[model samples]
Target: MLDTLSLYVAAPEILLLVMSCAIALIDLGVQTRLRNLTYGLTVATLVGVTWLCVEFALEGQTIYAFGGMVVSDPLGNWLKAFAAVAVLVTLVYGRPYAADRDMLRGGELFTLSLFSLLGMFVMISGSNFLVIYLGLELLTLSSYALVALRRDNANATEAAMKYFVLGAMASGFLLYGLSMLYGATGSLDLDQVFQAIASGRIRHEVLVFGLVFIVAGLAFKLGAVPFHMWVPDVYQGAPTAVTLLIGSAPELAAFAIAIRLLVEGMMPLAIDWQQMLIVLAVGSLLVGNLAAIAQTNLKRMLAYSTIAQMGFVILGLATGFVNGSTANAQYAYSASMFYVVTYVLTTLATFGVILLLAREGFESEEISDLSGLNQRSPLYAGIMAVCMFSLAGVPPLVGFYAKLTVLQALVASGQAFHIGLAVVAVMLSLIGAFYYLRVVKVMYFDAPLTATTVSAPADVRAVLTLNGALVLILGILPGGLMALCADAVLRTLAG
Candidate 1:
């Protein structure tokens, strides 16, 4: 049995599990018309979890609980806090859209989302490979159900099937890779695996071979090129509300996965994996940008854009520990951390605007559907423009700073390959800018296809406004967040 201190360290996860189950039961007893009660409880639960994460982060100690199965540390706590907030915002943006489509007749959305969030918390904190794999399954399963929540929609069901099949394959790849690592290193605990690899008793060829599968699994999760077949389909087929849920918060959890597995467990093999990441990054930037240029569907375009953004994250990861020296590891990892966090922030606002523009019986998913948004609602149009500009790496926005930090990290390594890769990333980003700028052009320059009033609830409006403002504010004064990321990565590495 776990003791009080161990339980206390894991209080957030414990509380979330309890709250999720309780909400499910309570929802069953509530009348269909009273769904808002369940929604309120879900939001409150997430708020409480966020507060718990904040408290833990403030303590700033690296403590292992459940005998090192889970860790209570700055990195996990920060990511957890952000995930909670992201889920809360996602629910806020999703509710109206769901209700409009009769998808909120039950509490399934709220419950499944909470469960998925719990999985993310576990993924962020897990110190064991099995624990991480378990969490990934929970998240992926919940997401599949959520995508297919509207069972009557053929496209949603089809997308869900694709997600399920691809997800299962990816999970299998990850598990097989872990088994290979266990065989090679004789341990499942990340720290032990790290020590074993450092000891170099294992066969080098076997380790590198396992790394191929591991990187392939991670690429699928991150939706990198050649492994990203499911992303655009799922994003386009699922309801916009579900797409928002899948896209924003999960990126934070995915970042945690990379940190735990690659940074903590396999830093010794950075050279091998770095080569794999470079190929993935370059392919992602090239495919994601060029493919997005031809997309007519807004959600599909953003999905491809997601692939591109993740390329930057991988670029940041590839720069850490250059030439077997970790002198620049802290800076490189911190830059990756910062990029993922800021990218999630920008994504939420972009999707929030999309959700706000949607109405009953209308999905508002087409790029041309956004014609003359400025004429209809300047507030939303401005918010969306900000998101687009930031995503395009335009100056005076958080995305620009995010890109700059990563590019700087790459260039600062003083390696010719790193510098050349940075240049390639810059050029790809410019190419990607064409699509983002096209959205802005449609919003401001084109004529409105529908003059429907873009009316969102006050709460949604308030949250969207804050989300947009944060992007710009962080751009101007990113030092604080940057420092937080650096500290988190540093403490994680030190521990």
Candidate 2:
């Protein structure tokens, strides 16, 4: 039986679970016109929970709960805290957009967002394969419903179907891989599986086979090629509000699961999986950057850009081990964590701008829709420009520092191939800059299509201003955040 005290380690998840259920029930009593009540409650819940997670992260202790099925550590805690903030910001930025489209018919958005956030919390804390899968299913199922929230829209319905189909297939692949790992190791706990593999009793070939499928499933989840067929469709088809919800925070959860499965569970086979990641990384960079260059729709372009950004995350993972030495593990993992954290920050602001521009009848998803945005709202245009510049890895922005840390990790590996790969990554990033800059150009130089002024709620404006400022602030004085990531990664690695 689980001890009562151990449960404290997962108090945030427990509290969030109860709060989400409570909000769901309470939302029923909320009048149609009073959906803001539910939204307020949901945001409050997230804020309270975020505070709890922040305390845990700052504490920086690693604790296991429920017979080691879940963990409480700085990495998971930080990710959960940030995920809560991201979801809160998503709801804030999305509410007006959803209300404008009549998509806030009920408390579905709030309830579903909370549920999805619960799923992310679980994914971050899970240490067992079954726990991780359960979290993933919960998150993906909520996302599917959220995407199809506007059932009247054919595009949303179709996108949901595609997402469901691909997500199901990816889940199946992950399950099979887990099953194979279990059969080989006779354990479902990640640590035990690692020990089993390290013991040299399991067949190396069988482990490698399972790794192939595991990597594929992770690739699909991360939207890496060739498993990224659904990202563009879903990004473009879902309501802009839904896109904001899907695009931002869940990425942190994906990073958590990747750490759980790859770094913690499968480090014994790093050489094998690292090779697979390299291929996925290279392929995603090529496909994402190249395909993004051809996109006229901003949403689709961001989706491809997401793939390319994930490739950098994978590239960070690939550099963790070279010539069977784990010397660079801390730096590599910390760099990846930094990249993911900053990327999510940039994405929230980017989508916040998109959501702000969205109105009752206009989607504002086209690059041309942004033409002369500076003339209409220099604040939003500047915010969008900052996001684009950050994404493009320009100096004095978080994204450039993120890319620099990742590339530094690779080069620090001191392998010829790793250096070559960094060079190629730089080249591809240069190519990706074209599209990001084009958005800036459209905002700054082109003629305005509509003279209507850009407007957003004060709360949204405040949050977005803070979000954009953090991207630049983190870049300019990256030491604090970088140290935070390093501390978290080191704590996790120590465990």
Candidate 3:
């Protein structure tokens, strides 16, 4: 029993939840091998949710709902919209792959994806600590189930077990940190916690102890160093389509929660958390890039690549607060937002190609599998090349601009230390470029493993082509998205 305003604020989430359940039930009766009806329903609901989010974002109003535990703001709305679109695109790419592997036998892929997306939406909108944690659990638990969807695959089962155990530990860390914060501030609401911290009546030592665990949990979610043991394993072991689902859209939710917990709730202790993030960023950049170069498995390489990309995002987060002044916070955070959005876009297309190449009995898990991909299908090869180049930060690709903004944020901080970090980032990026280029070199230079031509469903072909083109097009004209990010950040901060 909610009021009109509260319902309005939560409309998209409500719609998504009810429709996802309906579709799951509908799937129970769908007998087709393709489960076309279930997919259609899922896509329709996602489209409706995306449209609702876009409309809410365009209105640019911040509304606190459910007793102020949830918020609908331009930032949350935009993230939710992008996440929905990402999920929709993921389903499109994942369908044929899942079908080939018999992973779609029960339409579990569609229903589970929708439920996971519901988790992301909740994470993006949550304004209270407990609410945010609840969203996180929903997302992670759904993710674990998704990883284990192929119960017969030993690799997938192992990966799901690892994901569940580590994910549970991370959840415990976050929960304990929140409890400590609650003990210190005597509040579970984010606004109240912020006020209590700003008042500086609590013990700094207690807050710092809690902050340590909090930062660790956040780093684990971000796949940063020292807590990133699960990333490569899960990424390499899961079905490629499921890999795409886990890799792409969930990042937006993770970024949203980072902002909600760190920037919004705990800004009073900026110096402490920024230091922790700086350490994590540097380690992730160095370790992720160097580790990627040593990998022969394409999925594993991309997993490490994801770690490096997140390092850049973390760098942006670390610099948003400089020398006790919040003047540059919006610019720095917006740059992180832009980086994450573009990274997800590129990741979706990159994995799309991988999923397309996979056959019923043969998984394209090795780097050698992509040899001579350029000769087999120039269009898809070109698309993959664009993804690789974009990830390498080559000019006129979205990843280049994404890295530029993050580096610009770091350099703009005017601190010698941050500038030094920027220099290190550039050097580490050069190392990253080598690994990415290696993929392109194998695609173009090496001989074909087989003479069979690569083919995809018309829908996948069209959508993948569009997805690839957007990487280049958005790179060429990134102002629109960049502006959206900046405006959203400004609005969030202002509110």
Candidate 4:
């Protein structure tokens, strides 16, 4: 019942699964303070996975495997490659910090992170409701353990407990919604469900009722408003390295899941869900930007920034399916992809600096901690400045083009309300700019809290420098990535 090419289609996932388990076993015997053996193997595995994903993505074919419960598509493959690269960068930035805090005493961080990456792979490619739910649970459960990785820390324990309870409730909402759809359409497979919905045979009320909960669940995963309560607490309380790990890469997977569920599976119902996305986008922009201004803790401030950034991504999603038309779907969704990808890039650079500044028994959670960073280490300060500027959507940085494309998509719709939302989004971004620039001002203008220069391992230095440069370089030449996203989305719809 399975195609012979299915294994070829799933080679990356299969390779990752085998390597992750092998690394876990190998780490048991790794006693070095840095766990060099385990770390090298893990990095190599991720590199292989990334390479495989990119290769497959370039092939530009959509293959269904496991009886259509999984898909290998250009969009999914590229997103997976990005996720792998993000995790690789996170580990590079986080390992030295983890060692400082005694978090590297065990191999758990590496193993759990690898497992979580595997979960993301499943979520991105999952073509059935139950399979996607299982993938979500795998990712969240690993994340809960990861947030609680500092077992001795009270804040971490509390954060983990809150994440667990709230995450469980959100999972229930998504499952219940999926169940409603299954009952209405008599199928759990996404393609069949799409066919069912597009046939217009299901009752509108039932589909709408299910959609409400589904959207709620998706919003929580993306840290959108009303469901974003846990984001700040978890980001602040988790070990800084863990915070970077959580904040950076899983987002691509989150974006992928949104595309799979809403755009691919539920396009026929876009009229219903797009309205919900609009509301969520407005609330996220309003609350996230305003609340971030009041925060002095660097992690919590970035947490709110994350919420606001997601608002732009949501708007891009909302604009795609205007008036039940898929005419502009690829353009709108591609803009959202560019936004999430670039946002993740900037996030890595920002948090990498934060992780580097954190010293033994000294957390760099406070904004004042970065005071006069330029006086201490101009290289890192410049990197951090580039990140802040990009996040603030300054011109010639990736984030500006990201926002512009989404706004362009909105205006292309030619709807008064859509244009009005575009205006509101621009205003909210202006407010968001205040906090992002505030970090920049403090880094450049304030006096250094410590005269000691900041330092990083050579690998971290190289990766972080490349990352910061990309934010600027990509902004200047956004066409390649924009074209890739456009092509991928088009292939997905065609597939």
Candidate 5:
């Protein structure tokens, strides 16, 4: 019993479990007028968990649980902290929209979100293929329900169906890959698999095949070029709150998984996987950035931007610079992590503006809908401008630093071909800027299509203001966060 208890090592997961159950019970019995109670409880729990994660990060202890199935180190600790912050922002921005649509009660959404977060905790700390698969499934199932939360909308139902089908196919491929890997290495643990490959215990053919399939599955999750077909439709059709959660949290979770699989599990096979990732990264950058240029809907454009961001991350990881004594390797890892953090903040701020602009019957999501935003709501328009500039990778914003880090890393370690690819990436960034700025121009320079008053609830405005402010602050004082990101990546790489 003591050992079993030890298996539940992380305080954040334990707190989330208890809070989710308690909130579910309260939601069932509480009066309709008190539906916001779930929101309050959820926020409190997230805050508590975040505090614990921060404590653990400062303490710096690696706790292994479930016979090494899960382990909490600085990497997992920081990612969980980031996840909590993102979830809190999502809840704040989501509450008003849910209330306006009569979809705020019953605790189903909160419970699912908490559970999905729990899965994210597992994914970040997972030390074995079995644990990773379990966490991935939990997160996927919860997200499926979340996308379908607005059951009355046909588009929601359709989007959920498409997401489920594609997700299942991806999971199938992942499991098949895991099975083959297990068969070849005779081990389910990632560390053990790495050792098996390094010691020449695993057969080359089976190992390669498994690696390909696993990469394929993860690519789907990251929304890379060929595997990203479902992202735009899902983003546009799902509730804006659901979109925010999916956009911010799942990408972090996927990055954690990629680090585990590539850096730990496939260290001996890096040469092969590095080449494959380069191709995927280039394709994703080209396709995602170019495609986003044509989008009229803001959400769909963001979906494509997410794809392009993932490409940069993959490019950094594929450089095979991890083994050198040069600063190139450190730069590569820091660049990728920096981009991840920057994208999270940028996306949250952008979506927060979207939520604030949306009213009872109008979503304010289309590009044309933002016309004359400056005249109607100067504060909201200013926030939107900050978000747009950041996304465009302009100087003095976090996004520019993030892009600069990645490009510098690539140039420092890569050959002529990779340098060319990096140049293409730079050009794509410029192209992407055009669309992002176009939205800003419409908001400030064009005429409003209607005379409706633009106003947001206090809670939504507060959250948006904080989010917008953070982008500027982080851009100015990026050293601290960038160092933290570097430390996290170094710790993972060391492990």
Candidate 6:
């Protein structure tokens, strides 16, 4: 039997699980008014879990529980906080949209979201491949359902099917990689795998194959170049709320998974995977940014943009020195973490604006639809302009700092080849900027097609305001967040 103290140490997950069950019961009993109750419960549950995460962070003790399947550390603490904030923002931005569409009543959406958050916690805290895979599947399954939540829409169903099929294939790749690694090292725990590699007992062939499969799986989750085909369709088809959840939160969770698997589980094989990531990163950067130029649908463009942003994170990770090299690794890893935070904030702000602009009969998926937004509502147009500018990596915005950090890391590593890639990144960034700014141009310059009088709920407006303000605040006062990201990277690599 687990000790009481052990359970307390895992308090955040426990609290979430219990609350999920209570919410499920309430959902079943209050069928008529289930939407309000479920929304309240979802918010309350997230608040409680977030509080627990804060408590754990303050305690600042690394604790392993569930027979070492779960481990809580500073990195996980920070990531949990990020996940909580992402979920809270999505719920706020989505509530009115869902209610307006008459799609908010069922508890499945909130429950699934809660489960996904739980999976994120597990993924960040897992110390072994088995645990990581389990957490990943949990997150994946919930996302599939969330994508299909708009059951009446054929597009949503098709997207969910595609996501499910591809996700399963990706899982297979990951599981095969795990099996190979286990066979080679005779261990599932990351610490044991590292020890095996350090002892020189691991063979070159097994290590290479395992590394390839593992990185492939990670790339699939990140929607990186060769594995990114599903992203646009999924983003276009899923409900905007679902898109926000998957686009913002899952990317962060996937980044955490990559850090855990590569930095911790495969540190000894860094040289091999670093080369692999470099290729993947450059490929994704080329494809994602370039392809986005052709997309007129706003969500599809953001999906491609997400792919490009993931490439930046991968570049940061790839530049980090292998083995015991601390100086370069510290810079690279810290840059990657900072980029993740920057990307998350920008993405939330961008999607929140979309949610705010959508109305009863029309979803704001098209770039053309934003025409004359400035004339219709200058406040919203200003908020979206900030988001667009931030995403385009314009100066004095958080996105610019993110790009600067990654470039600095590349330069510090003396990888002059990255200079060429950096130039491509810059060029593609300008291409991306064209679309982003086009939205702004349409908002301010074009004529409104119809006087639809789109309006968002007060709650959504409030969230949008906060998200937009955060982007500028972080842009201007980035030192503190950058410091925290640096600390998180150092602590993770230390372990």
TM-score of predicted structure 5: 0.96
What is the TM-score of each predicted model, taking all chains together? 0.99, 0.99, 0.99, 0.99, 0.96, 0.97
Q: What is the C-alpha lDDT profile of model 3 across 1-495, one tens digit per residue?
A: 888999989899899889988998889999987899999999899999999999999999999998999999999999999999999999999888888888888978998898889889998999998888888888898899999999899999999999999999999999999999999999988888889999999999999999999999999998999889999999998989899999999999999999999988999999999999999999999999999999999999999999999999999999999988998799899999999999999999999999999853588889999999999999999999999999999999999999999999998999999999999999999989999999999999999999899999999999999999999999999999999999999999999
lDDT of 4 at 297: 98
Please give the CA lDDT of all the candidate structures.
0.93, 0.93, 0.94, 0.92, 0.84, 0.84
Estimate, for each residue in 249-344, the C-alpha lDDT of model 4 and write its tens digit: 889988998999998889899988999999999999999999999999999999999999999999999988766678888889999999999999
Tens-digit lDDT track of model 2 for 1-495:
668857788788888889888888888888866397798889889999999999989987898888889999999999999899999999988888888787887888898999999999898899999999999999999999999999899999999999999999999999899898989999999999999999998899999988888888899889999999999999999998888888888989998999999999999999999999999999999999999999999999999999999999999999998788889989999999999999999999999999998863699999999999999999999999999999999999999999999999999999999999999999999999999999999999999998989877789899999999999999999999999999999999999
Model 6 TM: 0.97
Residue clash pairs of candidate 5: none
Which residue ranges in model 6 land beyond 4 Å of their true spot? Answer: 31-34, 322-324
Candidate 2, TM-score vs. the true structure?
Answer: 0.99
| lDDT of candidate 4 at residue 231, scale 0 to 100 | 92
Task: Encode model 6's per-residue lDDT on 182-208: one tens digit a residue.
Answer: 999999988788889778866788888
Ranking by lDDT: 3, 1, 2, 4, 6, 5
* lDDT winner between candidates 1 and 6: 1
lDDT of 5 by residue, 218-329 (tens): 9999898789988999999998888999999778888889888887788788877887888889888888889999999989998998888889888887874545333465
